[model samples]
Target chain A: MLRIENLNVSIDSKEILKNFNLSVDEGEVHVIMGPNGVGKSTLSKVLIGDKNYKVNNGNIYYYDENIKDLTIDERSRKGIFIAYQHPQEIEGVNNIDFLKTALMARLDKPINLYEFAKSIEKLSNDLKLKENMLYRNINAGFSGGEKKKNEILQMRLLKPNLVILDEIDSGLDVDSLKIVCENTLEYLKENPKTSVVIITHYPRILEYIKPDYVHIMKNGKIVETGDYSLSLKIEKEGFENIGTNIIEDNK
Target chain B: MNIINIVNNKISNSKINNKIKLKENKNICIDIIDNTKLYIEIDGINIKSNIDINIDENVNSRIFVFSNSIDSKININVNQNKNSNLILNSFYKNDDVKENTIINLNGYNSNIEYNYSCIGKTNKSLRINHYFSKTNSIVKNRSVSNNDEIEFEIIEYVPKGSIDCNLSQSSKIINLKENKCKIKPILLIDEKEVNASHSSVISPINDSDLLYLMSRGIDEHNSINLLVNGFLVNNLNLNEEEKHILFEKYIFRR
Candidate 1:
């Protein structure tokens, strides 16, 4: 489980997340829905400890241990994975090498190359990715949808205890969305303890994964926390009406 | 055979003129000492020599001198003796040493490969020029210079109608201090039928590649050494013994 209390984050002296708080329990899928530039992605980057995002004030706890002093790689090793909305394209480093290196870093040992390839191949087939992609550079020249699938591949291979997916549905076609959602579902089914924090704007992906809890964020803070019907209500009424409700409630 | 000589201004200098008409296979080792001017001419156009040298071939091989003394000059004439293969190795270490090297290839099917390594400090400048005229010939050259307060310059010219030959040139400089080092590699291609390619990359070590490796728990120096080794390994064609010797001499510096 992961917990955040009054998490304050800023980039270049501009505050983005103002006293944000959230808690994710094991085996529960939490979907964070918000409009553009409302700190949905900032929350994920803050959790992943991106150097650009400065933590001005707050505390983040992963499994009841304070991880404020841990490095980004250390946090990753401690079962925190972030499937980037735009995965980095690393040139001259092959996909297989990158994956194996990541996996070895997680396990802290030299993994068997043959078994690694076999396991990745099985995952690739499940995710409907071409096996030949492993020979190319990591994410280089990949289409937008292909890049999203590659992120899922890493998530599957690493299999962290808590996976934070930031906007995985944006650029995916219907078929790709289906495959990505199905693979995620299958992963959660296999590993029952793995928790997920899905950040998205559209409710299409929720149609497949069926999030256990949904939270609506606006202007750097979560204004509503409810069951899946909140997402359905927002989809029907839209953010314009939702904005009016937020102002009236405050008044 | 004709001999060409030019002496614009005299510093401390030396002269060498040799002609071998029938020496088919020759092993020649020429050493340019510090603060000494040198000149040599090759005659008969049929003698083949394997030359090994030490200087900074990256920048102006004319003005820069790597020596303890103030002045040095060198003049070289290389004539082909029946399509020869000339292998040259040069090294430069000081900023006060100034030297000049001029080689002329006038035989068909001849090949010249020159490799140089230079470490400069306290104002080093170098100048080098080579001319090639023949058919079915090749030239492979590379240089490495590292340090601060070193100004290095190199200019190479290849004329027209030299068919069926290729030239490859590269220069790498590692600046460990606040020294000025410049690498100018020039190639003139007048014949459209010939093939020539040149690449020059002068950059400091990449921090991202280092951090990426270090994030995986690799030692800092080991990651740097790995990247530097990868850069230099492409420059040398090393036999087992030469590779081991270079590993100890340049990399480990023992």
Candidate 2:
């Protein structure tokens, strides 16, 4: 359902991603594994139409339409959602209010309040999130695990066709991470038509949600693409020997 | 639906005889709507404005006034007797407008809270003076101005040995256009025992924050609107209807 080819991105006259290529079909999950500062987050931002990262050369297609010309909201309307690595704290905007606005924007119609509350309660219970969080401001004073659960809750409510989870398991403890992984996989199982791109440096998340494709990103480009076994290899042996020199890998 | 229906003002000095006095257990509320205008001038000589509010008193008043000429000046004195409470809010914004306002208080055991939010985007000048005498009174002032055409000055005075009084002043201005603007907030504290603090920030939005929001589907105008709303939300004590009217009039007027 998603395809990116020959993507070249730069920021502040510094080249980051060079000719990266990847493709994920429907009912498939792709996990991008890479070290820090290796442009994993950059790829996520670029796909969501982040303006800071300039795309020097690339073509991204969702379904059959070119998404490079689309705005972030337009992309979101087309079923693209990005769970930010660092969730922002919006003080006065209630979490339920924000989710409703976003869901309505995506659906082009006002959601039923009763159904919304019911679904949110069910999802929160499954994700182990506090029910009182629905009335509080979005991510305001939320613990790291709480923030990740909030992201997943949004993902569930919006029901986007393509959901990008960026470093969602980093700050979560073992129990919370297990809960998050199980909830995410359950969502995917329910909507088997939906596709996901999980971005993380570790493979522990894979223990819960099995991925179809595993891609290693070093520097700014995708150096290797393999089945789920590739993820295990990267987990066992570090990314130091797989790609070229670190500088050339960065090129 | 309408809180204060009509505003009837008589500018002549004879109207002073019918002036209303607030008792120690009373509360007062005044509202304005539909192109209402009021011009008040205080000569700054022997001012006696006293109102006895009750404990846990609630006073809601909105005073909107602007000067058309350069020589317009108003002196206001409010003295609250001991153990009373008051909340005073003020908003100022005008172009090619000049006005001077002075407030003085003399030794009353009252807890008075004052808030001022000034947005001057045009050619204007304002001089404000505030002096307090009693202890344990708290004053908070927050002002934000856009554009560079307006000149503003604020002066504060805390008398000697006023203990437990706290005052905070915050001013933030953004120079969107190329015009000269100056904001000077002066705090004169003669009492070392008082708690006083002030802060000012004058600059445009950070490039990184701007980029961050823009990347999240918000354009420049919407980003600025969010920031401006955040800046003004704390001082907004409007009811539901008033808040709706304000959003319709000023916020969503585009």
Which predicted model would earn the best TM-score? 2
| Candidate number achieving the greatest DockQ relative to the actual structure | 2
lDDT of 1 by residue, A116-192 (tens): 97999899999888887886666779988888899888888888898988999999999999999999999899999
Clashes of 1: 32
- lDDT values for all models: 0.61, 0.61
For residues B50-139, could you state the per-residue lDDT of candidate 1 as single tens digits? 333332221111111122222233333344332555554443333333344555554555555555454434222223222345533233
lDDT tens digits, residue span A151-209, model 2: 88888877888988899888889998998888888889889989989999899899988
RMSD of 1: 11.5
- True lDDT of residue B28, candidate 1: 38
- Fraction of native Cα contacts reproduced by each candidate: 0.03, 0.08
Candidate 2 docking category? Answer: incorrect
Instruction: Show pairs that collide, candidate 2.
Output: none
